[model samples]
Target chain A: MILTVTPNPALDLTWHVEALSPGATHRVPTAAARAGGKGLNVARVLHGAGHEVLALATTGGATGAEFTAELAASGVPHRLLAVRAPTRRSAAIVDDRRGETVVLNELGGPLAAEESTALHDSAVQLARDAGVVAICGSLPPGFGAEHLGELVAAIAASGVPVVADTSGPALLAAARAGAHVVKPNREELEQATGRAEPLAGARALLDLGAHLIVVSLGTEGLLVVGRSGAPVHARLPEPLHGNATGAGDAAVAAIAAALATGVDLAADTDAAARARLDLARRATAWSASAVLMPLAGELSPRHAELEAAVVATPIHEESR
Target chain B: MILTVTPNPALDLTWHVEALSPGATHRVPTAAARAGGKGLNVARVLHGAGHEVLALATTGGATGAEFTAELAASGVPHRLLAVRAPTRRSAAIVDDRRGETVVLNELGGPLAAEESTALHDSAVQLARDAGVVAICGSLPPGFGAEHLGELVAAIAASGVPVVADTSGPALLAAARAGAHVVKPNREELEQATGRAEPLAGARALLDLGAHLIVVSLGTEGLLVVGRSGAPVHARLPEPLHGNATGAGDAAVAAIAAALATGVDLAADTDAAARARLDLARRATAWSASAVLMPLAGELSPRHAELEAAVVATPIHEESR
Candidate 1:
């Protein structure tokens, strides 16, 4: 079982219109609402892939109630801790005429201290039997970078591997907590490590005691660095053009799925190294497949074929 | 006290963005949500004017719960009859760059029959003590035109004046019920009566048993016709260029305000005729003042000055 934590989740609403003219009235032909935020997306994808996952988050107010209802309707297992403030809503207006989707994200940085603690406690309890704990997305209001670090340290103490997918100071905090794995996109890694080079930045995370780091490079693929001082790169043969909104989260989902199925990512043996490499290949394939879908937290049906098509290679310690 | 009934109420949301490009992400700098629908708007405006008003509607689900909460926060007295479905949301994305406001209205015509009946029953009961009863906006799903007419007649049975602001079948039904006052914009009046001329259409409504018919002509002013064969036209001397979204609702609010204060619109005496003309003048002034503001259910502070500047003339039957 995998436990996913989304501290600041939202009810994502998408509306479809024929056209958008500012200051004019438009009739929405279609609309959809779903649970959103980094960890929830990962949880959704992982659950969809036949993995047992529980999503934990703090929710309150009307938006929070709607979020809970939607999560229930999705049949996605989740536990919502009641808070005082209302959860946020993210609206995406899909204008098919221009092949554009305009998104409006409400700033959700007001999570109180007590609320954060409540959410953290619930998450830790849910992580007890979980094979992997994936801590994802933004910190709520008053939940600073240091708090994220403390959270990571506490979750990692449960003996369950923790995968931190976040950015900025929070990413650095997770690394310092010895999170089993830290996933950061290129920009996020650079922000955390102050290193322009992806490999160097990932190494920076490794130096902070992280057992593994997957630096997402968008269409360029991923740079996966392991605790044993080895690096593997994986990518599809060709770049696919589609909505890549949740690709990074899908990658985290794949990692959690691998961990749940007994893939030994931390083992230094030859068989373990080979398994870790294969995990990277599969994760990269799942991410690539996700890019072909229109909705986030969902995947394209071609994941199996994409997984078989991923090419991976090992990088020597001193590639220079 | 005035009782306003909005069968198909909604949570109106407005978002301000620098610019809108279809298919792109936009971060809203500001957003506002208000309880909306024709009768609610009238109720809000009347309340703002220091008049006691109660808004009654069917509400349920998360959105409906939020609607009730926002209404409570606004300090407007309201009765929310619980239904099995959620209320709808109407979003307006204001793009200042293009000087445009794009609106997206959800399809909101799927309410259950039992819910509609429940709302109507509560509204009729509340009307007993109300100085004036106003039935406004579209009839919700399963709430037909005949139902609105019956509602108006039932409310009128309490001897309280009933003001109906609606269109097409609802407008015609209200007229047929001998509603104390029926307000319809030019287009709606024409649509209901199948008459190209506003005056002719308004007269047709009077023949249907409406004691008074007000045809809103936007900046051109208002045409007030009574069953006794009198027509009074009132308008601001000059047109104001601004948002006129809820001007009609504002007019209805003014009429309800007049009735709540004991102004008679159906008396056959000369003093009553004079009072009815004054009501028309005040309502037109309120409508004109509303056109200068951005939000609906809100009045400009310059309403008094606008009211004094209204030009009105009573037309004899021969002149028509």
Candidate 2:
């Protein structure tokens, strides 16, 4: 079983309007809702791929109840830890006429110290026997960078590979814990390393102890760097553009699924190198496929075909 | 006690974003939520003014639960009728830097015919001893324009003057029912009568048997037209510029309060004519005061001062 932990999650509300005019009232013909959060998005994608997944999240208040209801409706298996603060809500407005979309997100209220500790314990305990454990999303209140590192350490000690998809101090914590794989988008990478060059920032993350680091470059694609191998850049031959909201999460899900399905990660062996290349292709394809979907946490069936369309190019050490 | 009925109510979610960029993820620093709808706004304003108020709304699902929770927290007495579909949620993204706000609203799902009938019955029963009964906002699903007319007739039969704050076919229905007071904005009046001239449209509504018609003209203030008196233009000497959301609702609430407290509505008589002018000045002051607030359904204490600053100009019949 694959274990997914979302420290902070939200209910995503989406509305469509003819056009968006600032300081004006808009009539939305309809609105759609879904269970949302960085980790929840990954969990949904993994579950959709027919994997046996267990999602762990903290929920409370009326909004939290509603969020859990939506999660139940989404058919993802989950263990909810009740808390005092309501889960946050996120909204997106699509101006169909202008083809523009605006997203608004709320930072969930502070989590009690006891509840925060309970969440860490739950995540660690749930990781047992799971081939892959993916801890994703923002750190909730009462959780510092050390909290993320501690969770990673506990999970990693169980012999299960831990993948972390987060940003800022949390990403630094996961890297320090030497997470098996760390995914950081371009902006996050820059922010974490304070480096202008994506490769320089990615290298800094690798040096910080992450076994492998995948730096997402938005429409540009992924830069995969390992502690002991030539870095590679992976992308589709042509950019397949759609909604990019959950593309990064899709990549995280693909990597976690790959680890669960027996893809070797040791970069020293020739077979391991092949496994890494194969993993890169799959991650690129999954990320690309996510764009074809209108909502996050969803993947298109054409991902298999897209996998074949991905091309990974070796980046010389001198390029950095 | 002031009684307000909102057939279609929603949870208003307001997000504060540094800026809005189409198709980009925005991190909302904070989000404020409140009970929202025309009647609810007026109810809140009335309640805020220390008036005994009861707000009646239909609610269901998670969003509705949140809406009711917020209403309870607001200290407004409310009765929520259970429905099948989840309550709708509206979102507003304020771009502070640009001084602009974009709103997106979802029309709640259609109400079942039986559910609609139950709502009407509930409103009529609740109006038994209410000093003023205000039927406000859009007609929810399963309700035709005729449904509004039926509701007005029922409420009016209970010896209570029904104040309708609505537009379009519902306004037409209310007029045909001879609602004691019907509040329509300039745009609504124009749309309902297909007349560009506000006076002409006001006359048409008055001819439809409305006892009084107050046409809101935004910053231009109000145009009050009764069955007998010539139309009067009322305004604050200087427009109070602020967020205009819910300002109209405040005006409606003030007018309702004025009537309930004993402002004569016999427009054909000279004494009643003087009462109408007094009511217009008070209503315009309340509307103007609402604009000074950051939140809908709230007003600053400066309403009294603004009331003394209002000027009402008599419009001769020849203009119509």
Task: State the DockQ of every prediction.
Answer: 0.46, 0.72
- Grade the docking of candidate 2: medium
- Local error of candidate 2 at residue B295 (angstroms): 2.4
Task: Give candidate 2's total backbone clashes.
Answer: 3
What's every prediction's RMSD, in angstroms? 5.0, 2.1
Local accuracy of candidate 2 as per-residue lDDT tens digits, B5-86: 9988988877767877778888876578898988899999998888888999999887888898898888888988999877
TM-score of each: 0.79, 0.95
* DockQ of candidate 1 against the true complex: 0.46
Best by DockQ: 2
lDDT of 1 at A242: 60
Q: Which runs in model 2 stand beyond 4 Å of their true positions? A: A317-319, B237-241
